[model samples]
Target: MPNVKSAEKRMRTNEVRAERNRQFRSRLRTALKKVRAATTAADATPAFREAASLLDRAARKRIIHPNKAARAKSRLTVKIAALG
Candidate 1:
């Protein structure tokens, strides 16, 4: 438990931020899954674009590492190419 008033406030703010980060992470995972599940290159293209956008946003916000986002985007692009 936070002993000081300021510490308590910080704890509350941290909890709020954690929840928001969780939501962003969940959305990112869903977007990646959608792209990977796509059966055709045409279907995957839109999903990949959306996932890439989400990855960039998440990386910019520090929810995920920038290199991790880049790696995911690269792997997804490869998968899409393989689908063709």
Candidate 2:
């Protein structure tokens, strides 16, 4: 129970932000999965780009750690490249 008014407001803001971040994270995972499942270089390149973009956005927004974002992007790129 937040005693102060500001604390209560902050709690509400946190709930909204948490939900937004969860959505972003879920989208990020789905994009990465699409990239990974791409069988051809043609199919993979765009999916990889989209996944990378999502990861960068999530990292910039502080939803995920920068190092984690970089690692995921790196691994996905490698997977895409190896498809050829």
Candidate 3:
């Protein structure tokens, strides 16, 4: 219901960004799950690295809070260590 041309364009931009963010968030969740799902420390190592990278990226882009990313990474490390 945007009557103004600029508002209409903004709405389109918002929609595009929302979809892109959703995809990125989904990937982040999948990466975290991959790390958590690994039962062995060896298997978890690689997944942890990938998940850590995604977490940092998400934090950098403000998709997630930096502290939240750090906390998740810490928890994953603990989980992997417990698997050891």
Q: TM-score winner among the candidates?
A: 1
Across residues 1-84, which tens digit of lDDT does each residue of candidate 3 receive? 989999999999999999999999999999999998898999999999999999999999999999999999999989998999
Clashes of 3: 0
Candidate 1 weakest lDDT stretch, 10 residues = 2-11
What is the C-alpha lDDT profile of model 1 across 29-52, one tens digit per residue?
A: 999999999999999999999999
Worst 10 residues of 3 by lDDT: 31-40
Candidate numbers, best lDDT first, in rank order: 1, 3, 2
Q: Please list the residue runs of candidate 3 whose C-alpha ends up more than 4 Å from where it truly belongs after superposition.
A: none
What global local distance difference test value does model 1 have? 0.97
lDDT of residue 49 for candidate 3: 95
Q: Which ten residues in a row have the lowest lDDT in candidate 2?
A: 75-84
The lDDT of each candidate is 0.97, 0.91, 0.96
* Selected candidate, larger lDDT, 1 vs 3: 1
Question: In candidate 1, which residue pairs get closer than 3 Å at backbone N, Cα or C atoms, i.e. clash?
Answer: none
Best of the two (1, 3) by TM-score: 1
Task: Quote the RMSD, in angstroms, for model 1.
Answer: 0.7
Q: What are the TM-scores, per candidate, against the unseen true structure?
A: 0.96, 0.94, 0.95
Residue 53 deviation, candidate 1, in Å? 0.5
Model 3 TM-score is 0.95
